[model samples]
Target: MNRLNLFAPDVRENPYPFYATLRRESPVCQVDPNGMWVVTRYDDIVAALKNTQVFSSAGLRVASEPPHLQRHNPLSDSLILADPPRHSQLRNLIGRAFTATTVASLETRMRSTAARLADEMLQRRVVDFVPDFAHRAQANALVQLLGLDPSLQPNFQRWTTDILSVAAISPDDERRMQDVRRSIDEMEQYMNDLLASRRRQPGDDLVSGLLRSRVNDCALTDEDLMGFLFLLFVAGLETAVTLMTHMALILARLPGWMDRLRKELDLIPHFIEEVLRFEPPVHATMRLTLADTELSGVRLPAHAVVALLVGSALRDEAKFQDPDLFEPARRAQASLAFGHGAHACIGAFLARAQARVVLEELLSRCRRVELRAERLDWNVSLNTRCPLALPIEVIPA
Candidate 1:
């Protein structure tokens, strides 16, 4: 088989068919010239996630950095890229602050926010939901959650984009590296200032709570604090944006879906579940091997790059019946979309809550969802399969 061109136009459009081919011929084979093993089978992905000892998350920082270029990435201090005791400690602390109770409490206000966002979309007549709606909703929720001013959102998102871009670009891109470093430095300073202000006058927001909370009688230091904040910017809030965009795009492209959802409002959850399985926001996530390991009898060298093809595995034939079909009514089993095991996304509850509330508001207000754009462009990020824009015209109910 020719080395899989994952970013090629055909795969970008829909990768499942290509992934099925991989599962048949090279379940654990390295399909790329880069020697990165793309794991497509459902069972193997789960096993790798659970076996954190061998498939380490720590390798992310190491993998991204050039051998000669050395610098501290605050994300290195986060649970997002750590293992065991440190990971558990960070997860518990952050998790406590983002509890179901705290998130649920935001429902009333969040619902209002979503309605206002939908209203804005309605007024536009023709709107690109990706930026006009999804982006705004994500930013609004993030600002409210962290108790920061919405005016600061542009900078927050810019920093997030710059930092995440580091992973996508070649290590030789010194200018990109410099820009990312600058963003990190500025963000650290900004967070320090924000933390100080919060300390002076505490509030009910997460930042204030994070400051006050203790895990095992130990408070999060600057490193851990910066790491968590960066994670929230880069991964947590962005996931919700991608989920909402994907859901909206699904509704737009699938003619009968909205009517079906409107008739059976209870199917909303299943609809969301199916969208996650069918068009997952995250296509692949990297895991570095801690030691020499074997996957499906294929020996992998220590520190070898293993990309868990979540999008591919979701449609793995052995796992789901009619795997290629977008069947919301299919048995809703846990998907690796948000990930699995210890490193499963901590902000998943928040993302789902946001999606449920926003989609609810959208459905209630809009009678008809029309896809104005004849063609859609997908973003180029290897990890995230987000539409670049989703222009739509909605008829008011």
Candidate 2:
């Protein structure tokens, strides 16, 4: 099989080699006869993400318009998938919850939660960072931020994972598709019930905040509300968890850096940013061309699927001085990990805050954290880049 087909399994284990080939040879190469142009250069990807008029986010999933997406109509008119006026309005409404002050307020809680979880995991000697530490921290943070019942945290995580897996599985994978469809229905029902409850007894949370916001003298419709909530649950939690796992894995590899961080705990923020660039939680983002456009001299047809390899872009030698090296003290440059332009991650501040807290707490408590296993079991999905299980041994401080 060719290098592109390697993405199916081998790349999932470690995609850096294939990603390097894509970046070096054909920054805009078509993969596996799919005709989906993979754009790896930093400039090209950023340009595409910024120019929403030419390269739209709409019809992102339907690169080939699968029968399931067409038949079931699973792609909701969510802000992430929508273009223009609708995307702007929805983003504005949801933007309120992620303001600087709002995100800052959650720091104490995030730190305390992280410390407690780390302490508990330390007692056990061996723990899967994904479920025990990363997932717990992310899910709990979302529950507090979104004002959802804490009991539904696991359910929400499961639902979000299934939803993301849709892009990876074959369209003919009936069982997987049905599983995702069922999960979506369950999530919708859960969100509807939560919304109804909030209507009766409002609280000071993201959901309640959205309930109070007005978009052009109109309240958020049920579909809009559910879609926004779904987006938050997926984007808000998943990325953070993935970043946390990546941080832990990197720290294990670079023990000296971990030791330095443990001493100068204040540098945790910079360290997190470096981790984000060196090993981003998200590898790529897909965009559909709204009109025929020339990107990096390659003319793309209308509605063409352009997969911007964000992981490669972050490592582009042209952008950073030592792109591949993880240097926390180096002046931070713009990273495509959280994306750029108008579609930049609304929860960027919140994600940073959470990561800082987690890293600080881990470094402060644990004297040394080492990889207990030889290889990482990474999660393979079209969008999310994360480890399925990260086993680490936390030596006491």
- Quote the lDDT for 66 in model 1: 49
The collision pairs in model 1 are: none
lDDT of 1 by residue, 128-240 (tens): 88778887788888878888777887786678777777666676788877888888888878888888899999999989988887877988787787889888877865678
lDDT of 2 by residue, 1-397 (tens): 2438435767778777777777777777677536677888889888888888887887674642356743332335467787777788878776754467776767787888998999998899788888999999988888788777888876867788777766666878888888887887787777888899989998877788788877568667777787778777888888899888888888888888878876777677788888888877677888887788886777788878777888888888777787767898984754678888877877777778888888888877887778988876667656667878888888888
Off by over 4 Å in 1: 64-70
What TM-score, computed on C-alpha atoms, does each candidate reach? 0.95, 0.93
C-alpha lDDT (0 to 100) for residue 280 of candidate 1:
79
Q: Which ten residues in a row have the lowest lDDT in candidate 1?
A: 62-71
Model 2 scores worst on lDDT over the 10 consecutive residues at: 69-78
| lDDT to native, each model | 0.82, 0.78
